[model samples]
Each structure stands twice: as structure tokens, then as C-alpha cells.
Target: MRILVVEDEEAIAEGLKFNFEQEGYEVVVATDGHEALAAVSQTDAEEFALIVLDLMLPGLSGYEVLRELRQKQVMTPVLVLSARTLSEDKILAFDLGGDQYMTKPFALREILSRVKSLIHRHQSIRLSTPAAPADPAPAAEQSSSTQGSSPGRFQFGRVIVNFQTFQVSVGERVHSLTTLELELLKYFIEHQGEVLSRTRILNHVWDEHAEVTTRTIDNFVLRLRKLIEPDPSKPVHILSVRGTGYRFLPFPSSQDVTDEEFAE
Candidate 1:
């Protein structure tokens, strides 16, 4: 597998490249956002399987580069690495089409795991989609694992999800989400139209004995809001339960919502 490492810090970039190369991956390094964009465009077309992007950069910011790439329809999966661990910052990155975000001072092993998981998940999603008439069924069948999964697409206000593949598409850009995001989205899809409290979501999604704080849930919800909400600030699909929690209003009709208001 080939990967792109985009970071302004020289030591970090070199260390990552060395580690990835040792893992049998063809590694490419870029010092800033402009160089990162050029490296992606110039590399074997769409061959760079993953990108490790740092938020702060010299010439162009990582956010700008990511937005530009998505605007140009480059579907390469990106894992953002930033010193900013705030919820709002993470939300903005996701809104701009990032697949995952990690804070600075992070362990190299964790980064490697995330990179591998993202690439594997993306490959699975692409393979699970229905192929064109020219393609053979046997090859497609061989690509996906028929494990614990369900059929039928998950629908909620212009969003469609394939549970088996863990694929989600909003507007036209298909995002390759991390494992945690996929699980959370699946839970919402399963219980659409019902208000689910943070406590309940925590127990179900993060395992029963999880000691994780509520802020984690909030961050995850913020990221989800960026994806499914038409106007995330004034949500429509995923509605706030008001001093309580949240509700996933699935496939709400025009009658359920006003032209300017969120659905009932």
C-alpha cells in the first residue's frame, strides 16, 4: 500500500515515513499544504491510498488543501493530525471532508492503527457497492466479507448508508468514516425517529463498562451533525431533544418539516 504523510514538522514527517516504509508501505512526504496537494495530484493519479495531514502549515493550511482536493473530487481518505483537540475544531475538519482526526503528542502505534483501519474500511465500502454491468459478480462477491451485517440501504434525509459495507454518502461526496463513526451512525439508523439520550447512546455505542466522559459523545454528535444536518447550527435531521439528548428523524417528508424549520 502507498501512503502520503503531510506535516510541517520535519522530525515528525521523517519518523512517520520511516515507520510506514518499515511496514512495507511506499511512503511519500510533504512539508506543507501546497506540497501535499501537489504530491497527491502528481502521484500515480488516485493511487495514494491514505493521507496523514497536519492542520497547521506554512503556505496553505491543511484545511484549505483538504477542501480544495474534495472540491476537485479527489476521494483519497484523509486522517487529520492537529494540536487542536477541541470539539469545534474537529467538527470543522469533518465538515470539510476529513475521515478522522487525532490530537498531537499521539503515539505512532495509534496513528498506524488508524491509518490501516481507515484504508481497510474504505476498500471494503468500495467493494460492497453494486458494480457496473461490465464487471463480474464473482470478483465483487469475493471482495466483501459476509459477516454480521444487514441488507437494505439506511435512509435519513438525503443520506443513504450500507451497513454491511459501512459506506455513507451525503450530497455527492462519499466519506470514508472511521470504525467508531460507522458504529455510531449505525446505531442512529437502527433507532431513527426516536429520541435517544446521551446516557443511552453511551451505554450502547461505547460498550457498557466504558468510563468515557460525556464530552466524547458530544464530539461524536457534533461530527455527525456536520454530516447529516442541512444546517448543522439549526439542525433538521438529527434534532436536539432539548435539555435531554437527540433524535434521528429519518426520511422525514416535506409535510413533517417547514421550508425553513427542522422536521418534527
Candidate 2:
């Protein structure tokens, strides 16, 4: 697999390239965020398996690089390796769609392990190429299970999501969702019409040991709202319940049209 190493420090970048190449990975070293972005956008450039990004860069900061990548709907898994150890830094990275994170002055072994894990997880989901959106289906009537395996396709309001392919459509717009985004949305769909606490979502979807705070959940919800809600400022499908957690209402009201009626 090919990996992009975006680090300005010469020694560190060379060391990582050497180690990753030894481990059977084809590594491309980009000394700054601009180079990394160029590598990704250039048509002849090869598709990368993963990216090891650094926050400090010459022309563009790693944060800007990651944000632009996600904004363009590039779902390549990114592992942030930065010196910023603050919780807020990590939170912003995740909010901007980073897949994994690690601090600098890092050990080579752990980096290799995380890179392998991220690549494996991303491939498991296939970061699929866009296909024709499937015919919209009625929302599931059964309760979404918190255990066992995740279900496949789900439609609510005008949104149609294929959990298997990571393809989603809202009205006429389609989106490529990150793995975490897909997981969180699936959890909401499974428990449709039920109020889910931020804590419970963190535990079930993020795992109990995840270091993220409830604010991360709020940010993710906001991102999801932009995709599925008609007016994010006045959201109807995913509702906020005062001081309690949020709720997912598949059919928020009587006047709303079924997805089938709006099919093209």
C-alpha cells in the first residue's frame, strides 16, 4: 500500500519513509502540506492508502490541508502526527474529519501499528467510488439494534445512506462520508425516533475508552445536519432536547414527503 508522509522536518520525514518502506509500504514524502495536497490532487499521482500529517507546514498548515481534503470529499484516511498535545487541537482535527491522531516525538512501532489499523479499517469499508443512488426505501420499522452487526441501507426524509458503500444522498446532492461519520449516522438510524444521550453515543459508537468529549458529538451532529437537514439552523430530523441529548426522528412531521415521491 502507498502512504503519504507530510512532515517538514527532514530527519523525521526520512526516518518514517525508511521504516514504512521496510515494512512493505510504498512511501511518498511530502515536506509540507502544499506538496501533500498537490500529490493528492494531481491526476497522474497514485491513490494513497493513508496520510501521516503534521500540523506545522510551510505554505499551508496541516489543519488547512485536512479541511480542504474533506471539503473536496476525499475520504483518504489521515493520521495526524503533531506536537500540539492540547485536547482542543485533537477535537478540531476530528471535527475537520481526521481519522486518527498521534503526538510527535513518536515511536516508530506505534506509528506503523496505527497506519496499518487505519488502512485496514478504511479498506474494510472500501471508500467506494460513487455509483447511481439506489431507489429510496421506506425507513425501517423495527428498532435499531445496539448489538450484533450493523444494517445496510437506510432512508429518512430525503436522505438515502448505503452503510456498505459509504455513499449517501440528500435530495439531489450526494456525499462521501468518513468512516466515523457513517458509524454515527448508522447508530442514529438504528435507534430512529429515540433520544440518544451524548454519553451513550460516545460509549456505543466511539467505544467506552474513547478520549473524546461530548462537544465532539455536538460537532459531528452539526456536520450531519448540514447533509440531511433542509435548514440546519432550524433542524427537524435530528432534534435537540433542551438540556438532554438529541433525538433522531425519521418522519418528523405529517406534511413531509416520503423519499419515494421525490425520487428522480
Best by lDDT: 2
How do the residues 1-264 of candidate 2 rate in per-residue lDDT, one tens digit apiece?
889999999999999999999999998899987898888988433278888899989999999999999888787878889999899998999988987668877878788887887777667544332222222233364233311232456665467786666777887889888867877877776676666888888877663434478888888889898988898887777777656677776656543223332211
Off by over 4 Å in 2: 43-46, 107-109, 126-152, 193-195, 207-211, 241-244, 253-264
Pairs with backbone N, CA or C atoms under 3 Å apart (clashes), candidate 2: 144-190
TM-score of 2: 0.74
Query: Best TM-score goes to which candidate?
Result: 2
lDDT comparing candidate 2 with the true structure: 0.75
TM-score of each: 0.63, 0.74
Clashes of each: 0, 1
